[model samples]
Target: MHSSLNDHMTLLKEIAEFLNEETEMETMLQGALKKLLTRSVFASGWIFFIDGKGKHKLIAAENLPPALMENDCRSMKRGGCWCVSRYHNGELQKASNIIECQRIEQARRQSEKSSGEITHHATVPLQSGKEKFGLLNVATPNTIEYDQSELALLESIAFQIGSAIKRIHLTRQEQEIALVQERNRLARDLHDSVNQLLFSVTLTSRGAMEMTEDMELRDAFHDIHQLTQEALTEMRALIWQLRPKGLETGLLEGIKGYAEMLGIHVVTHVSGVIQLPSRIEETIFRIVQEGLNNIRKHAGTNQAELFLTVNSTDVLVILKDDGRGFHAGKIPGTLASVGMQSMRERAQAVEGTIEWISAPSEGTEVFVRIPY
Candidate 1:
């Protein structure tokens, strides 16, 4: 009993962690149902989420028979081992023996078999405010009894999941609003900054050409014009970074450019066909740039290698420098450094990842991966 209780506590803790981390309702519910199965409490469980059209869809399930997983939720009949009907029309429901629950009379009637038994199920109606969100159903051979502690844990998970879903929905809305505002702000700033500065420099150069008789001064004016153009280029890059979802530039262009850089000899080997979204392209380029620059600035190694390979469903980008590598744990979290934090955030935003493979004598390596 002691061991079992400890295991149960651990499961609840894990459930709480998952609820806290999961922002999407479908994902949270799906994860909760699965976590519950980790213990012997519920032999099997599945979650059905109501869709926008008021249709109940079994979006996720745990401990489902392998055969049933491939098919639609509606296909499962009363004999199904574990199924949760996310029906919000009712309140907290507990059926010791699903076979005894008269609620599934239709399933009994539909089956012309020797035994007309409804599976034992315990369902807790999930609700957020007045609206019914979904159902969490677990099925077992016998009356699956849950005490106050168990029910409380499940209810707590339900509440946490509900809150997370709510928070995510609000966050999504706020982000959308912020994006619109940011777009307008960037537009205004672009006009006031880069465009104006470039236009003034161009006109000034023209005026100087027409009025100045000294060739040396004219040359100097041309130099100023060149420098202003370079600044304009940087401005364009900044704007590009601000709105990086533009995948049109392609990863090929970025890699080729990196190869041309003098200090960072990014020996690259790319094969097959690969494509990425604009956000991904920009992130890879920046990560590569930062990694190489770090090596140049910190690592005393003279060599670096960059490799790219594309496969169905995902793309991989690797950049490594054969210089002294520092311990990843020892690294400080400060923007004052280089691009470490930016690289991490960018990878996470796309559901991708980066690994820093360097320690002491080992060279530094930055790896990036993203779903295609």
Candidate 2:
């Protein structure tokens, strides 16, 4: 009994240290599950993350029999099981004996080969106080009952996992808040200092153009006025990029506002609701901003077309302009400009794809698709 107690204490200490040290959510969960199954009596273990929308994702697993591991754990991925149903219904409150494993039973019925000795498992709600994250389950071969001490240990581990998840989420939220604050501060500084100075220069140059009488002096003043106005426009664009004003309303509105700021007329069409995570919204907004800026500078026309389609699975955007187009094939090796490279990198960062289509005379189109 003394030896068992010592082992349990050591396991708890190691797990606590691991959880505290790991910052990433998926890596932490997978590593912790591996530790539990290896050092403990449990023959197999798995974790499920159920979001507020009731979507269930199998986060991690270990020591699964051939049956459950088939087809990338398809048996575990789809359909509702007893424990998960209880979880969704708010009935599972502690580590307790759940019904015979539905996944095992299904696997048995489907395949003639022996499915494994495991039939029943303990289900524990992974929760920190009132907020619940998901469920953790562990099982052993031929096990039908779990002792009070074992159940208590499972509960303790579940609690640790829950607390770690909460801590990681809060840290990310705090970081995001800090980043927004910094961006706002920079935007304010540019607007107050550099932006105002550029405006003043534009006005002074325009006045000089009107006051000059010599032809060459007048032309010089006119050139200065034009350059100053262009500089002021670019400064405003930079400020808007730092703190996009219409992004709070919606992504479409934000894109429209940006195009307007760049003096480009965009005809937009939308298919679905324009709601997305902030990161995705920011990415798409910046890509469209770059596209519009290119149209304003190189397209020889300020008119553009934007098509946005968002569905349950993915988001698609196409921005097209009627401009003198270049050879798309030649762009990869010869004309890979920084703007094009930046747009491609942003799309790839979101696990998305972006392409440019153009010819010598035909218009240019930028196509972007990002999966949810």
Candidate 3:
């Protein structure tokens, strides 16, 4: 018994040391799982990460059965597990006997063809204080029951895992918030200094154009005025993209303002009220900005239409322009070359989808669908 206690203590120390190292969430979880397997008697284990949207994502797993891993672990990814459902429903707060493993039961039903041995598992909610991150599940092939000490050890590991996850999440949130704050500061500076200066230059150049009588001087002044005006337009677009003030009012209003700044007439159609998470809102705004930038640079038209339909589940955004369009198949170069890749990435960051459709001489269209 003393040896067993020493082993548990050593396991706890090792987990503490492993988690303290600079490692990503996945790596930390996997490393912890490896340590747990070495120190304990569990045959297999996995971790579910609950995201901001309250969706459970299976981030790490080890020694999972073939049936479960089939189809990209569709069953686990779909959140059909008994332990996860209990965790979501606030039933399983601490490590204890909850329900039989659904994967094991399914395998038992198909025992004739099942490949690996299965056994009952224990699950513990990984949480820091009141913030629940997810669940840690462990199972052994043998039919041995856990003692109080074993359960306590598992709970301690779960606590460490939860604390590490919370730290990682808070750090990421801080980084993202800092980035947004910096972007806002830069946008303000540009609007106050560069944007104002450009506007003044445009007005001064136009005044010179009107006052100059010589043809050459008048033409020179006119060119300068047009250049300044174009520069101001581009600068305004950049400022809006960096920090959209209109988003404070509404997404559609912000987008309309941006389009107008680019000298593009936008016809907006809205169906439902616009309500979304801030990250999703930022992604949609960036996507629209990229689309408008492409229109100004390549579309060769000053008219565009934006359609937004929001529902409880998702938001649909379609931006169409009647411009000199190119063939979608032969997109001159990579999608990154035309900013489509960045837009696609932003959409994907929110578990959204974006598509582009265009044909030579026919208008171009950008479609985006994001879940709230």
Candidates' C-alpha lDDT: 0.62, 0.87, 0.83
What does candidate 1 score on TM?
0.42
Clashing pairs in 1: 86-135, 96-143, 98-118, 98-119, 98-120, 99-118, 247-278
In the predicted model 3, the residue pairs found to clash are none
TM-score per prediction, in order, is 0.42, 0.78, 0.88
Off by over 4 Å in 3: 51-54, 104-115, 271-273, 332-336
Counting clashing residue pairs in each candidate, in order, gives: 7, 0, 0
True-vs-predicted CA distance for residue 34, candidate 2, Å: 3.5
lDDT at residue 299 of model 1 (Cα atoms): 82
lDDT over C-alpha atoms for residue 285 of model 3: 84
> Which sections of candidate 2 miss by over 4 Å?
1-6, 43-46, 56-93, 96-123, 137-148, 213-220, 329-337, 348-352
> Model 3 Cα displacement at 309 (Å)?
3.2
Worst 10 residues of 1 by lDDT: 77-86
What is the per-residue lDDT of model 1 for residues 1-372, given as tens digits with 9 covering 90 to 100? Answer: 678678767887888788778767677777777878776566667655553333455656776533333324334432322224224324234322333333233344444432212244655555566555555656654443656556655665556555666677778889867985797589669968776888799779868866899999988888888788666654554554454332345665554454344244667789667655555666677676566556655787658788887776667888887777788777733431546877888788877898887788887778888864
Q: Between the candidate structures 2 and 3, which one is better when assessed by TM-score?
A: 3
